[model samples]
Target: MNLVLWIFTGLLATALLVSTVKAFLPREKIAATGPAAEWILDFSPGALRTIAGLEFLAAIGLILPAALDIAPILVPITATCVALLFVGATTVRLRRGERKTAVGDLVYLAIAIFIAIGRFGPWAFTS
Candidate 1:
């Protein structure tokens, strides 16, 4: 369970880091957009910025809430939310016939779901 948590933490942290970096990058026009880019661009830059902020916050929530044992519910909530986002992302990619992107989202979704279940279920950490 600890191993699972660590893996999930690493994955979420990596995602948060990458997305935050991307949010600061120059925005390009949505030309020749792929499935993932198209889906992300459906939301305006402001909305995407908000979502990226939330993702970064959620990444902190996954670790901090549990570690501090304050507002512990946040851990599972973050995991669940990220998992759901990945699910939607995977669905969009699949619908767009983007197998590689769908697979990547599936991997993320699986890790997030595992973290959600582990944190909220029997393996819950208590500090």
Candidate 2:
């Protein structure tokens, strides 16, 4: 279970880091800046960047609070927040008629919820 949590944490952290960097970068220079990127940037660059920053913060929240043994509750809180973010993303994708993207969001949402449940419920940290 610890291994699974670590793996998920690593994946989410890397993804959030990359996304936060990309959000800060100019749209034209963004590596994966495709139609989706343009769409998001067009709608509201500030909002997108805010969300990216939140994700980065959440990523850190998941690990730091528990690893340092200070405010371990932050781990589950972050997990829950990330899960909610994914849910919002899924809803946005669905509303935009992006079925494929919605499916991807569903997967992310599931992982985030799993982490929240594990961290806050049965698999909670003891130390």
Candidate 3:
């Protein structure tokens, strides 16, 4: 379970890092836009950068605590935050009638939830 959570965390963080970095770029700079970008484009660049910053923190938070063996409890806490982040993403997608993108957000939300639960419950690391 720990291994599974680690692998998922690594993948999730990497994917988020890429997407979040892209979010930091000016919308006009992007050659193309996806459904998710539709919602982001509705907001100001500052808003997009804010979301990107949160995502950057989340990506690092998901692994830093556990890897450093310091305040490892933050792993679950950060995972909870990631789950919340995806909930917002999914909600925005649904509001915009982007069902396909919403489905992807749901998958990410599920993975975040799983990591949170696993780390907090049976797979918890004890120092």
Model 2 ranges off by over 4 Å: 28-32
Please rank every candidate by TM-score, starting with the best: 3, 2, 1
Candidate 1 residue lDDT tens string, 1-127: 7776867777786786677654675445442454456566556778778777877887788878777789887877889999888887787788778787688888888889888888888877666
Candidate 3 error regions (>4 Å):
none
Q: How many residue pairs clash in each candidate?
A: 0, 0, 0
Q: What TM-score, computed on C-alpha atoms, does each candidate reach?
A: 0.80, 0.87, 0.93
lDDT value for model 1 = 0.75
**How good is model 3 by TM-score?**
0.93
lDDT tens digits, residues 3-104, model 2?
A: 898689778767667777756777555525664544464446677778888988988998888889998988888989988998888877777777866777
Candidate 1 vs candidate 2: the lDDT winner is 2
Error of 2 at 55 (Å): 1.1
Query: Least accurate stretch of 10 residues (summed lDDT) in model 2?
Result: 34-43
lDDT of 2 at 117: 88
* TM-score between model 2 and native: 0.87
**What is the RMSD of candidate 2?**
2.0
